[model samples]
Target: MNKFHGIFKQLFELQLPGTEALDLYEGYYAQLYEALTSRDNYDIPIVMEQARITGGPVLELASGTARIVKHIANAGYSVTGVDISDDMLAIARKKTEMLPQRIKKNITLHKGNMIDFQVDEQFALVILTATSISLLKDEEEVECMFNNIYEHVKDGGRFVFDLLDDESFENSSLRMGGIDAITLNQSPIPKQFILMGEQRDANHSKRALMNFYSEVIAEDRTYRFFGSTEKTYFQYDAILPIIKKTGFKIIQIEKKELAKNEMIYMFVLEK
Candidate 1:
């Protein structure tokens, strides 16, 4: 990766451990939910609605912010949410506080690695929502993670996940464009944040590099962001074969016709 990409990745991956990642997310959690949920014809609710099918134990892998977990819990289902980032979980725990008493009692939270979270009891339904399953760093990790999910789900139970179809990326690649400059002044520690540049090709993949230069006024410390490309690109076609080899079956798909750019498909596999 180029210097800009490397720096972008570092900022996202490392600063979250010590900086305003958790605090910033906690502050804006509800607002983020409202903006994302209000978008018309989103399929997340469809997956959350499906979680009610058995009313049995439901485990959401990589459950960031727990927005769906809160909804599933409120609907009277036993839910357990697990995520890799403590920063994310911190915000998620705070959000769960808004849930009703009975639902709050039914929901449990665990912090662990997504590819290898250990649990004795099998769940009736296993879900990885909001394109989280695609976050695995590579194809090998993806296969292993899916295998792990397969092991955790009970027989006949379903594994649900959503992704933007590859064709969407293919189409968008042609429109490959850059972002306008915008300042994010939310951090107590000032950051010079910019979407430096982007490279989206016609075939399938797109790459965008973001830069964050933070100065912590109180601590007299300055650290360069460790990560690069806040938004990485992927081809859904490249991901599907890996999903199939991991023994998953595609059961239902929700294609957004209004905005083809926002197509989200749900993959359900029976174990």
Candidate 2:
């Protein structure tokens, strides 16, 4: 075992206290991915603490629905978010519209892939949360992504991100009851079902698709969106060389049990 820094426990509180079962509604693809995603409000505090620790303007890559970035903005930090999907950005934009004017000006959203996304400004911290980078799977993709992150990060700045390994997800299929949402600026997500499919491999890389049959109930209205999220085994050892070559030094590596049987490896890298 290796230890880099003293154990720092209890950063912030978690919202997903586990939900009690309730009857679900019959609906379609309308829910904004809050039910089964990090939007469930459990992981938000961890990422928020990361921002608080680093204390700077943030540049978040692969910013799906711009969840973490939005929260960072709400906390009074300036943030620039980049994502590849227009559909995801649209949902994020809708949420952004509901934020206060001051917070609205604090956030900037860009539609672009992680590999080649360009922003005019550099940030004191660059983040890739929700384990989104792990879905890249390919070694080259990971390398390119980090190289791009280096360019957007100022000297002596840090990059913090999380990686999820599909290998930890044991069940062939999994189910969770309706999560009681934490309200807006936080989420009004409702019921959801996630089926983690079998992993497929090619050229020593693995890919798994998590199919969500969602039935989300917002506060005032009901909406539902069924979607598939991809996960790939993130082999940190395989990418360590690439990361160092791109000029990032591993400052700290922390492991947290985000959920039962779900381990998250958070890498804090310094440029």
Candidate 3:
């Protein structure tokens, strides 16, 4: 078996250490999301331009913490943000509460699953940004999500999203066995955290699983350790047919190369 499968099996069968680590890890993700979106240029310009062309009301799937949706609403579009994680939506609600009434009035938050959801109205633009498309684990889930998106968007409306290219996964170091430290200056727990893991694909599916363990040392030298696993699937050739089958015509594709042998692909599709 591949290293990822072995690690995942271990994680699944064993009791993880530090029950509080899950809460801390969630807090870490919330802080990271906030910091990434606080920048002026995060995902605002690209999505805003699409919203302007397509016209609103806009719907954002997997709108974690309302990072991009809030900005889109602030730009004067009526926006709805949907996320399955209530913790993330709670943070989004708190942030939305602080916005001006004009902007706040245009924003709505929903706690729902993206694969199966219904809205009272259709949208001119539907978005799934920040590599959110990869969160769907398999072809069936992707199909379900695209069908829902099709239903939610008006005819001729636009759907836009970004994904991490397959090349990145192919080129990545699958055996991350040693300590990997990450430091975020803006995070409340500013000290570095250590991560170790491996990523590998499943035998019967295109899905890839990443099994990781994280540890951090607090200021007082308290040690917190956490274990987590994530699964995502993406391939340019494989996903294109799926999108086409869902009745979306690909309009534009943008590619960006990042450091560490990673790449990003942005796709704009029309219903």
Which RMSD values do the candidates have, in order? 6.2, 11.6, 3.8
Q: Candidate 1's residue-wise lDDT over 152-191, tens digit each?
A: 9887788887765546654355234443343444444344
lDDT of 3 by residue, 51-99 (tens): 9899899999888887787788888999999988777888889989999
lDDT of 2 by residue, 62-126 (tens): 77776687789989999988887766777778889898898999998999888889888888888
The ten-residue window of minimal lDDT in model 2 covers 2-11
The per-residue C-alpha lDDT of model 3 at residue 264 equals 71
What ranking emerges by TM-score with the best candidate at the front?
A: 3, 2, 1
Pick out the ten consecutive residues of candidate 3 with the lowest summed lDDT.
16-25
Q: Estimate each model's TM-score.
A: 0.70, 0.71, 0.82
User: Which scores greater on lDDT, model 2 or model 3?
Assistant: 3
Choose the strongest candidate by TM-score. 3
User: Over 4 Å off in model 2, which ranges?
Assistant: 1-32, 41-46, 165-196, 202-205, 212-230
